[model samples]
Target: MKTPLLQFTDNGIYCKKANVYLDPWKPVDHAIISHGHADHSRYGHKKYITHHRNVPIIQHRLGEINVTGKEWGETFDVNNVKFSLHPAGHILGSSQIRVEYKGEGKTSILFGYSLGKAQRLLKYLNTDIGEIYTHGAIENMTEVLRPLVDFPKTTLITRETKKEQLLGNIVLAPPSAHGSTWIRKMVPYVTASASGWMTFRGARRRRAIDKGFVLSDHCDWGGLLESIEATGADKIICTHGYTDIFSKYLREQGYDARTEATQYGEEETEAALASKSTASV
Candidate 1:
């Protein structure tokens, strides 16, 4: 039972023995994507699986291929491995993957991007399962807060405050084809929510400033700890945030969790180039 070896540059998890690639967007044979974000979706793949709704976007970009789409909770079989797409609550067609190896008799759930607050745009996907119900009562204002629960599942943004305040609910969903619009909107929200622990949600796997969602697409600092407690995954590998803070929080929770921070010296260069190119366009 080994945690998958994830490559930092590509954010691709490759099983050398199985020869399977998870979320490989750079022209791989099989690219199992968590969402339709450009960084997660790519062309020149022999076959792949993604959210059912994202099929339109993927096909529109990648043309023809062996494309398999899955709805939430539906397990699909590929190469003798059974995996199900769970709602990550990042965008319209966002999903977290739950992989079950029938042969190995193992069940593991990976949150491609999970959120605790249910947004208005995607309230239909709210589910009462897990700690969401437990934490729903933390603040009376958050009673209506439902995130990634159930269809059109996406991320939710709450205005944090040191002194209790009623700032109304703010939701952050993917505005355009890519996550640029969402990230743009996230800047303001992050500034607003900086008082408390801010979770930079959608841009987890990508190594760029504008490549993903800027909303709290996953459980926030508190949410992360709580969800980790509920799911009880043997080993927790947290990527995509301030390493020291996440590690400290995880350690205090009495879990065998650790941070995996990947360094990408050239990543910033690529981001700058992309930003410049987009500006020119």
Candidate 2:
């Protein structure tokens, strides 16, 4: 039989054929990082490879590490293993690593922080629908990513924007801003929060928001199903929360699904993004 392409090692997910680790939980010799996040891309690793867009952010956090940048779809071979990077859409530079072993292929989604969700929202938005406003934190990301890629226009939500400007507007904000003082000025506006927690009715009701959008960067049930189907893999592995439940559900659907016991937390989120007034200071 052909050798396995990837396996869960003591340190993290290891690509045996490539001799590299993917988003390793501990320091390793070669780490193919997915994105720049405190937890996912931790400090200390021999060498790193990720998308070109993520290099700056990763460097900012890791500080002078050995890292190589590759544009989307760029491919390279290492020790008989072929690897390529593709946009994962969770954050800027977040990537899905595609590995080929013999004639079979598998992919790992490398997502840590999902500021990229903020990026996707701008792609499909109907600006004609209404004016778009963002909490200062979101606006800052927009400023960083706007020039790198195409995104919709958004105005920062400020004390000066005036209440009248928010009428029938769409505002992207952090979960903490849901009940904060900044939005008191926009009273009577429809309030909605985006989070994976919104999958629970209790989470939504507890927040007291008018609506909750399940706009998490991490894959949901439907998204996982779609991704798995698209991969055309005969078997599936569940790495994180609800793994057993999700795996069972997938098995019931007739696609082979199994849960992999791994120590990975839920994808980190900027759920508590604060306003510019505070972020600036």
Candidate 3:
């Protein structure tokens, strides 16, 4: 079955396949959100679907929108297209999206952000530009030009050299086995990865950061490729990344892949876009 050609936009559609909105940032009549992140979940909606635990968060954000909570593995149909939510791992209630078209019976493309370490599992580094000189580096002009950075290489090395230095063991929680996994034993899945804003507070907790596993909120190059391979997908639509490099890499691997440059945010829809052009003229 031909997977409905997915058009990358704030709101998504598959004419023959049930429409699936990855994460509705704009005001939509009906919506399904992957998580409660401010960028993903926004105001205005008649009904919204999300994780059961996120109902409160949704309510707080969207006010009176009818919030529907979905458990992992449950399927719902929207205009004949079947979509199911799976754990995304970016946050407590994040999900990776899977959609199927009833007409084709072929599994539609799987939209995954690829999982990352939990919010609490990592501490980010924070260095202020102003502090570089204020902390006595002002004495030497040459020293001011030099950059200073702190990475947790020592802690990682220590953990590898001495097991006692390891505060906690790293455990890889395999993706859901039966439904999402192809083999049911071990198949890789992309978790929603995000880059966090570093703060001075996080810099103070460098020890904690060192002890935790470092991962991204969006899929890295390797993880993106792995997700594509795991799905056994014939064609891939890459977005939200350095698409040129990723698409080139995918093509090198003999996969029919293309990169999609989506908009900055929902603020730029077709109608809104047309209006901007008119206003500019």
What would the C-alpha RMSD of candidate 3 be, to one decimal place?
23.6
lDDT of 2 by residue, 142-214 (tens): 7888779988877776655766666656776655555566665566566655667779768767867666667
Residue by residue across 203-256, what tens digits does model 3's lDDT show?
Answer: 314422222233335555567778888999999887754578778888998989
lDDT of 1 by residue, 101-189 (tens): 53322111111111233232234323322111111111221233434233333222232321112121223222121245323422222
Stretches of model 3 off by over 4 angstroms after superposition: 1-5, 10-16, 103-281
Best by TM-score: 2
Please report the TM-score between candidate 2 and the true structure.
Answer: 0.43
The model with the greater TM-score, 1 or 2, is 2
Which lDDT value does model 2 have at 102? 53
Task: Give lDDT per model, in order.
Answer: 0.47, 0.71, 0.46
All candidates: CA RMSD in angstroms?
Answer: 21.9, 21.1, 23.6
Q: lDDT winner among the candidates?
A: 2
